[model samples]
Target: MAEAFERGGQQAWFHDHGHWGVFFHTYDNFQLSGFGEHFDQPRKIHVFIPRDYEVSPDRYSVLYCNDGDDIFFGDGETEQSWQVAEKLSQLYLRDQLKKIIVVAICSGDRHYEYSHIPEDDGGLEEYSRYLAKGLKPFIDENYRTIPHSTVILGASRGGLAAFYTACKHPRQFPQVATLSPSFWLGLDSPSYSMSNLDKAFKIKLQNSALMFALTSTLLEPDLRPKIYLDWGLRDDPGNEYEIRSQCRCMEMIQVLTTEFDYQEDHNLFIVEDPNGSHSINSWGDRLPNILQLFFD
Candidate 1:
């Protein structure tokens, strides 16, 4: 049910001199078969350890992300990545954040599993198991990672998956950051992805909020895990009347808080990039700050 694959020795599109000490390992969740027979490349996941890791080789926090191919690394030049490796490299050098391990789990037929739909593959627990259960243990064994200090992250569509991952498995990944989650994927009209987020946090917070921390499994009675939500307000090229309503998303979240009765101040944060748009550059510019607020 668990195996480690490798994309070793292949030409990398985003690997550059500045991305020093970066080592990658390929992984796949081939056992995860939702589409049945038609599914290919099932066990594909990537582990990205920073250059600093070799020198320190100490236990570090782990951040798991979706969109494995494009987030931490890219498939080709035109498919530019989020450049997180370099960004973290600079930050680590300047001491903006501590060194951490980033595990990117690729999404095969992501549209199905990344969604909440019951019938589709996105809810494919097989892939999730390979990461949260199988692959993660492998990472813990090989790399110097804090027993659990695992943080789950995702952007755009990946964002929604990150949140869902945290919500369902609060004990494993207590802290989560979603940068413009593609919540709109499974939602209906008059309600967007933001609506889904509203329900998740409001209804799902544990008592201790310390689930993601290495030492904690339960959020304190009044305690809650740090949650970060970032969204930009800009006219999406594809959607006309559907320009992302960042403000409305915030409003919906706030309303959910009141209705759900969770700690308003401690549970959630909605950061707005007022002048920002929807793009890697936009999300990248704010990644470090979000890390500080949530994972630091």
Candidate 2:
């Protein structure tokens, strides 16, 4: 209710406060925030501060996500936005779920940023820097964030970025959730569109190898984040790969888990939703669990 902040902050539910001064933040002087030569000017980042920040006098966990364009809405949400704010509010009513401040930093390059094909170094490292070095510090200084409980999440390429960032910089983010990641990225070739399906498969397979190889270092003893990944096998309407994505997802999960096992303390999970697909709606299903992972 009260159309929390702006439409982009659709899910934010202010506590019993009268809801007078909830401000929707934009890239106002984000450039002046002490970033060195290593940082790039962000297109824009929307910051949502819950109304209770002052009255409650408690530190709230921070949830950072990609694809802000459709994640929040007062109405007319594309049936996929997390609907997280709404769900959590209801849960908060029933029991003891902690409140949180969600920082939805959006981007249009869903594929270019999430996928490794176009990124200089799988796009994960730079993106991780943007968050750990730039965004995360800004939040810590400007807002009260639970340093150890902070989370990063996404779907599709955003999911890939979330997973990559957590693995690459475990100390920065202790929790992560990614749903229906288009692991198909870096693999989708122009040839796939040109009807050369076999060649496309080859390209994806090759890229997948490289991507996983890079993630191997993430599980090193010193850096390990609690990770959650889920996917739907029967997506794409009529997938012709026979035992394609499902089997592949399983295999990849196995790989990641094996690596995590080597670490002394790492919690990694893979939930397979039989009827899920690569979409926002699918990710929304895990909203409750995702929140509890860090907030609770």
Measured by TM-score, the strongest candidate is 2
lDDT of 2: 0.61
lDDT of 1: 0.60
lDDT of 2 at 117: 54
lDDT of each: 0.60, 0.61
Quote each prediction's TM-score: 0.72, 0.75
> Which tens-of-lDDT digit does each residue in 176-288 have in candidate 2?
88776656555553224424545545543323643564555554655667777777766464443322444445555656656445322336666777767665666777678
Residue 118 in candidate 1, Cα distance off native in Å: 2.5
TM-score of 2: 0.75
Cα lDDT of model 1 by residue, 96-174, tens digit: 7877778877666767667654544445444444456655666677678885588888876677677666655566777
lDDT of 2 at 2: 36
